[model samples]
Target: MPRVTFPHVAESYRSFKMLMEDLGNEVILPPRPSKHTLDLGVRYAPEFACFPVKILLGTYLETCPKGVELIVTSGGVGPCRAGHYAQLHKKILHSLGYPVDIVVFEPPRLYPLDFLHNIQRLNPRRMSYRAIYECIRRAWRKLQALDNVEKLTHKVRPRETIRGATTRTYRRVLEWIDRAYSLVEIEEAERSALEELQKVPQDPNRDVLRVGIVGEVYVLLEPASNLEIEEALGNLGVEVERSLFLTGWTRDNTWAETTEGLTVKEAAMPYLPELLGGHGRDSIGNTVLYAKRGFDGVIQLAPFTCIPEIVARTILPRVSEEHNIPVLTFFLDEQTGKAGMTTRLEAFVDLMRRKKAARRPA
Candidate 1:
C-alpha cells in the first residue's frame, strides 16, 4: 500500500483528500502553505517558475520528511506549463534524492484508460467498477457541499455587521459539511450552514460593492499563495465572486459537458473567441459576464510569469473601458507583500464606492 500526500490548495481539497482516504489509501495532507513552504520552494524550484509551481514544490518538500511514499497529483497536458508540471516536480524530487513515486492522474482525454488505471492502484478491495464510481460520487458530494457553503459566504461576508462573523461561521460550516457522509447529510449541512450564516447581523443598506475575481486556477484557488485575496476583499466590505469552482470544472472536464458555465463561454466570444487553454478564455468570458451583470469592478489575479493570465491581462483594460467598470490586476510571486496588497485593495474599494455614488441620481 502506498502512503500518499498532496498539496492542500484550498479547503475544497479536504473533499478530495476524503476521497483518497475512502479509497483505502493512507493520505497525508501537507500543512497549509506558509513562509517556510515558500522558502523551501524558492530554494529548490528553477528560477522564473511561476509562483504556484514554487509553492507546490514547497508543499511536496514539507511532506517528504514525514516519510510519505507517494506524491499523487492531478496532471494535465496542453499549451501551458501545467502539462509539464508533474514531470518537472517528479524530476526535481528525484534530483533531491527523495525518490518517491509521483502518480499523475492523467485525464481521460489523453488516454481513456489512464484514469482508471491510476485509480486501480488504490483498489485494495478487488477494484470493482461500482466501488470506484461510489468513491468518486462521495468525493463529488463533499466538494459540492463546500462550494455551496462558500457561495453563501461570499454573499454574507459583505453584509455581515460584525467583523469576521461570516468567516467564523464559514469555518464551522466546513467542519459540519466534512462530518457529513451521505447526500442527505450533505444537503442538511448546507441548509444548516446557510441558516447559521443568516443569524449574523447584516446591514441591508450598507452600500456594498461587488467585484468578480478571475484568473488561473492555481492562483484563483490557492488562498495562501494569493495572500487570501477573497477574505481580504470581504473584510474590506466588498462582495467577491470567484470565477472557478472545482465541482463545475471537474464536471466540465471529466464529463465533457458544459454546465451553466456555457453561457459565460458564449458571452466571452465577443472578446476572446478562442479556447486558449489554461482557462485564459474563461477569464475573459467571466469578466465580460460579470460586467454585463452590473458588477462594480473586477480583479484579475495571476501568478508572476504566468502566460495565460498575461494574455488575459492585456485585454482586460479594453473590457473595462467598454463596460465602464474598473479592473485591478495583481501579479503574485514570492515577493508579494501584504502591506502593499492591502493598500491597493483599500484604494480599489474606495474608488468603487465613489464611482457608485457618482452614478446615483442627483
Candidate 2:
C-alpha cells in the first residue's frame, strides 16, 4: 500500500486521515502551517502564488521525505488558480527529484468519470463499493462533528468569563473528535463536546460585537493562514460567525449548492451575478446576509494576489455602504504580521462597538 498524504487545509485533515486509513492506506498527516512551513513554501513556490498554495507546497516538501508515495487533494472550478495546484505541485516536486503521484478529486459536475477514477486510485486495496460508501459516510460524520465544535467555539469564546477557557476546551474537544471512530462514537464526541463548551462560564448579559467572517475558504478556515483572527476577535469581546465551513463547502461543491434555502449565487446576484471563483461570490453574498441579519460587522480574509478575492474586495465597499454594514478586508501572505493584524482587529472592534452603542435607545 502506498503511503498517502494530504495538505493541511484546517481541521479537515483529521477526518481525511480516517477516510484514507479505512480505505487500507497509510495516511501521513501534513504538518500544520507554521513559520518554517511558510518560509519553505515561499522559498520554493512561485513568487506570485497565493498563500494557501505556498503553504501546500511547504506541507508536501515536509511530508514527501517521510515515505509518502501519493498525494490526494481537491480540485477547483471557475477562474480560481486552485484548480491547477495539484499539477503545479506535481511538476515542482518531480523537478526537485521526488517521484510521488498526485491524484486530484475534481468537481463531480465537470469531470464525473475523473472524480470516480481518482477515488479508485486512492483505494489501493480496491475496497468493495459498499465498503467505500461506509468509509465516506463515517468520514462525513466526523467532518460535521469537527465543524460543529468549531462553530460552538465562536459562540462560547466571546462570552466566556474565564480568559482562554474556550480555546483550551476547543483544543481538547478536537483531540477527542480525532480519536473517535464509527458513527456512534462521532456523535457521542460531538454531543459531549458541545456540553463541555456550554459549561464554560459566560456573561450572558454582556454586550458583544457580532462579526461575520467571509473570504477565501483556506484563509477563512485555517488559523495560521488568517493569523488566528477569530480568536483575536473573541478576546476583544466579539462573537464571530464564519460563512464557510468544510462540511458546507464540501456539500455545495459535491452534492448540494443551496445552503439554508438560499444559494450564494442567488444572494450575490444583485452584487456579482456570477461565480468569480474561489469563495468570492459567497463572500459578497454572506456579507449582505450578515448585514440583513444584524451583524455588527464583517471581516473578509483572503490570500494576497488571489484574483477572486481582489474582485470581491473591490465590490465589498459598495456592499458596505448600501447595506450599512462595516466590512474590513485583510489580504494575507507569508509576509503578513500578527501584530499588525491584531492592531487592526482591535480598531475594527472599537468601531463596531461605537456603532452598536449609537444605535441603542437613549
Candidate 3:
C-alpha cells in the first residue's frame, strides 16, 4: 500500500481523503501551508513560477519524505500554466531523489481513458463498481457540505456581534466534517454546524459592506495564499461572496455546465467571450454578475505572473467603469504581507461605505 497525498488547497483535502480511503488506499495528509512550506517551495521551484505552484511544490516536498509513494493531483487545460504542474513537480522531485509516482487527473474531456485508468490504479483493493460509485457520491457530498459551511460563515462573520466568534465556529465545524465517515454523518455534521453558526450573536442593524471576491481559483480558495482575505473582510464587518467554490469549479471543469440560471460564461460574454484559461473568464463574468446583483465592490486576487488573471486584470477596469462598480486587484506571491493586505481591505471598505451612503435619498 503506497502512501498517497495531495496538495492542501482549502478544505478540499477532506473530500479527497475520504475518496481515497473509501477506495482502500493509504492517505498521507500534508501540513497546511506555512512559512516553512513557502521557503522549501521557493528554494526548489523556479523563481518565476506562479505562487500556487511554489506553495503546492512546497507542500509535496514536506509530505513526500514521510514515505509517500504516490502523489495524486488535478491538472488544467488551455493557457494556464497549471496544466503542466504535475509534470514539473515530478521532475523536480525526481531530481532531488524522491522518485515518487505522480498521477495527474486531467479533465475527462481531454483524456477519458487516462482519467479512468488513473482512478482504477489508485484502488489497490480494486473496489467493485458499486463501491467506487458510492465512494465518489459520499466524497462529493462531503465537498458540498464543506462549501455550504464556508458560505454560511461568510454571511455570519460580517454580522456577528462577538468578534472572532464566527471564525472559531467555522474552524470547529470543519473538524467535525473531516471526521465524518458516512453520508449520514456528513449531513449531520453540516446541519449541526450551520445551526451552531446561526447561534452566534449578530447585530441585525449592522450595515455591512458586501464584497464579491474573484480571481484565480487557487488564491481565492487558499487562506495562506490570499492572507485569509475572506476572514479579514468579515472581521472588518464586510460580507464576502466568492465567485468560485470547490464543488462549482469541479462541476464546471469536469462536466458540461447544466446550471439553470445565469451561468458564469453568459455573465462574462459581454466582456470576455473567449475562455482565457484558469478562472480568468469566471472572474470577469462574476464581476459583471456581482455588479448587477448590487454588490458594493469586487476584489480580484491572483498569483503574480498568472497569465489568465493578468489578462483578467487588464480588462477589469472596463468592467468596473461600465458596470459602475469599484474593482480592486491584488497580485500575491511569496512577498505578500498580511498587514499590507489588511490596510488595503480597510481602505476599500471605507470607500464602499461612503459610496453607499452617498446614494441614499436625503
- Candidate 1 weakest lDDT stretch, 10 residues: 250-259
Predictions in order: lDDT: 0.83, 0.89, 0.90
lDDT per residue as tens, model 2, 1-362:
77999989788999999999999899888999988898888988999999899999999999998989999988888889999999999999998888999999876788989978888888888998799999999999999999989988998899999999999999888998999998999999999999999999999998988998999988998997888899999999999988888878532531243334555566689999888789899889888777777889999999999999999999999999999999999999988888998888989988998888899998
User: Which lDDT tens digits does candidate 3 get at residues 1-362?
Assistant: 76899999888889999899878889999788999999999999999999999999999999999888999999997788899999999999999999898999988788989988998989988888788989999999999999999989999999999899998888888999999989999999999999998999999799989899999989999998898999989998899988888888533531233333566788789888898899999889888778877899999999999999999999999999999999999999999988888889889999999999999886
Model 2 / residue 291 / CA error / Å: 0.6
- What TM-score would every model get versus the actual structure? 0.93, 0.95, 0.95
Off by over 4 Å in 3: 249-261
Name the weakest run of 10 consecutive residues (lDDT summed) in model 2: 250-259
Query: In order, what is each prediction's RMSD in angstroms?
Result: 3.2, 2.7, 2.8
Residue pairs clashing in model 1 are none
After superposing candidate 2 on the true structure, give the runs of residues whose Cα lies further than 4 Å from its correct spot: 249-262
Off by over 4 Å in 1: 249-262
For residues 103-130, write the lDDT of model 1, one tens digit per residue: 7887777887988887787665555788
